[model samples]
Target: MKNYKFIYVLIGLTFFLSSCEEWLQVEPRQSIDSATALSSQEAITAATNGVYARFRSVALYGRDFLAIPELLADNAFNTGAGNRLVGQFNNQPGSHMGNWGTAYFTINQINLILRALQEVELPVEFRNRIRGEVLFLRALLYHDLARVYAYDPTADIPGVNVGGVPIVTQGTLTVAEVEYPARNTVDEVYTFIYNDLEESLGLMQNFNMNRRPFFVTRGAVAALFSRVALYRGDYARAIEMSEIAMASGVANFPADPVSGWRTQVQPESFFEIVFTTQDNIGANESLRATFMSRVFLNDAVAASHGNVVFTDELAAAFPDEDLRRDLIQRGLAVNSGVFEINKFASKNGVPNLDNVPVIRYSEAITNKAEAHYHLGQFDLALTELNKLRVRAGLEALEGITGPQILDEILLEKRREFAFEGHRFFDLKRLGRDIIKPTGNVEHSDFRILANIPNREIETNPSLVQNRGY
Candidate 1:
């Protein structure tokens, strides 16, 4: 309890000192001082805000989550314009995403907050909303960790697949409380996430929080649940939750996606990581700087690293008339030779600053569409898929069935979420090998799973490293 109180004071002070930086890096401790720091509504709100603030780090949605997946799969090519993402693009050993520490750290904060909420008294409405948001966040973090560190339940290699990431729900404040945990089964980790999200939705009901798209809401939870279900091979649940998400009315497909990318907040976003001038990651590290050469959308000169670009194959997949193709344009100056991605082109009217869309309505459509295909509902799948086809200026298909529909669905996912980071995960979840310009990575290869951090394996006797590393 003493440790928890000290950590809360540290977190509170960090928020005042730095808007969102050091607090997340602080080693998570045991629990919150529910009687003091978390006893008031104001303090709880600040703590909750601090939790959300962690998403802006380059390791999370701010950069790695968006850029690394595309590079690891076939959707992108590292331009070598900067010293980032090249290893990921090359699929080098032990060069995969390093989100483990940050994710686990954030998860500890969430656990502490949940424990505090249960002890602290507040209005029923306020308590439910706060608890629901943190629950949803916990689910999101665990799902991401599982997908990266373990194989999908539907696609695990029989002999080579190890296990899911460690499941740690309690906040660690002292050496006595520290645990040397072993990995859970992939299904076990997913089951934990499913339960968290289900409870989160139940708690959030009738709590009409209005911070749509920017913060967690009933709609975002449902939309994310839909995606999670698809990853877990729960087709009916995926379809059901997607309908619930669209019905929530928090997000909608823009009538014009070409112009939507230019908006500060994506019109199709169910949940987005909001960034302000104060939070700007700047030209060297922002998503905009990594994917685009121009500092701003309409700048005359190309003056940034532009580290990643669409693969020649991906650029060719989009037809000449497809509006999405226009988003990939020829570069200028230092980046002149190759085509650069414009999806992150400074939409916030600030150089190298754009809100990162974590999940969008379009993804819900694709998730349901793919789910329907898996269930052999070919006609229903086509009906769901035509929604995106028509939106992307392609003619709707009337006569397509079997694997062909599946192919089209996957292709559209690549096109729809190219720079936004769905390609590798889409291929991964489906047990598809990654085909890249350099070489092809087979589905059964050990490299399919990211290496567990070496330090974790060294310190924890119970922890087992992934096969290759």
Candidate 2:
């Protein structure tokens, strides 16, 4: 999270001198409103930058998002060999806090940008696009938040009206006034997310950009809508939105293998946050060296610590002829035994400058497959899943029924998008409970949703604590 502390400090000072309004007005620094402060193109761009800035924050795209969720969930396990503080999140307080901190920080940034966008004057089209993008981003953040914090509304607690985290839409507030708001129902939050993305798809349809996948486009909004709908169990809507997104041709997979596979922001990427070597903000120092290296070799820190090897379960899941195993994993012999690491790592000695693909064509394909399966289009689901399999040089699946096909699709998703932050959410939405190595089991309860930060709670009494906090 970028420092909202500075903003908080400014707000504090403004209140401190409330009695001396006349004197404060005489000072040039004290007169600007939040809107007036960010009215120009430069300022608006800076505000947009704030949104992008969160992508690298430890809470979002940073290692925490990738590591914590997996470790806490069943997708992966932390070795608990190094960094005990991080490894501790396999349980309750630690798990909740880690997720809560990350989500709220991202939400706070979006709220700030949304507030700033309200005051800026730009071309109507551009302004509308930007507003739509902000709404989409905020909705995306909330969607993730809802998934992590609350139980699935469609499953364990069927139709249960559980509350999610506080909904913060504005950035204008004193520290005292801005702590937390009451939890909104999961239904309410999902509704807000769906409505935001629905509007965003319409508003961003014609947004033009020099870089195809660097900014939010109509396709990104549509893809997000599909994802959001899938989470809500609206399979029909999910299939429809994903089909529309794919039909746009914005997410067509390219034929250029090296450039296409290695590039962070591909033409097929609906939306992605670009992370250059110069601006990398993730906390995992060895992440670049681990994932970017061509060979399945780990850095000394990772290799010595034994933190980056494939589990036996995952290795056994792939068939011998699956080409994705060759494309993504590397076999290494250690102590006369073999192990694997996902191949998406940067090639040998190459600095991993590849921008992270936040949303891509493959996701659309998988979304379509899942939706189709849910809609009882078993053969059609298999067709879509096989399209990705063939692209990865694997043989097509055969003789699978609708429900059986869902398992195959999820397994393929685990293999295809491993270590890319999709696994935990996939498992959760599918109603798979996480059984932790610590012997703690997380069943479907709204407890999975994280509580608002204690700092926020102290400042704002209105903020409701998440269940089980």
Top candidate, metric TM-score = 1
Residue 95 lDDT in model 2?
A: 57
Q: TM-score of model 1 relative to the true fold?
A: 0.93
The most accurate candidate by lDDT is 1
**Steric clashes per prediction:** 3, 14
lDDT for every model?
Answer: 0.83, 0.62
Query: What's the CA RMSD of model 2 in angstroms?
Result: 6.3
Model 2 regions more than 4 Å off: 1-36, 84-93, 96-109, 115-118, 156-161, 173-179, 208-210, 254-260, 264-267, 282-286, 289-308, 327-354, 435-442, 445-452
What is model 1's C-alpha RMSD?
4.3
The residue-by-residue lDDT of candidate 2 on 1-469, one tens digit each, is: 2146547645543532232222123232334344344555544554555566566655666445555555455545444334432433455563542556555655665665566566666778767877787888888788877877676656546554456656777664455544445877778888888888888888887773443776777888888898888888999998999988888766777653234554444666887766655555422443443232223234432332224334456667667766556544443333124343443454323444345667778888899999899889998999999987887667788897957898889888877776566866776677776664555555555545555566665655566666556
**How do the residues 1-469 of candidate 1 rate in per-residue lDDT, one tens digit apiece?**
4455445436644443344333422224323343345556766676677778788889899999999999999988898887887889999887787888788878877877787788888898888889999999999999989878899987878698778888888866444566678999898899999999999889877653467688888889999999999999999999999998888878888875587788888878889999888789988989988988888777888787898987888888998777787688888886777888898888788888889999999999998999999999999999989888888898898888899999999988888888887888888988999988787998887777888877677667788898878
**Residue 254 lDDT in model 2?**
62
* Candidate 2 TM-score, true structure as reference: 0.81
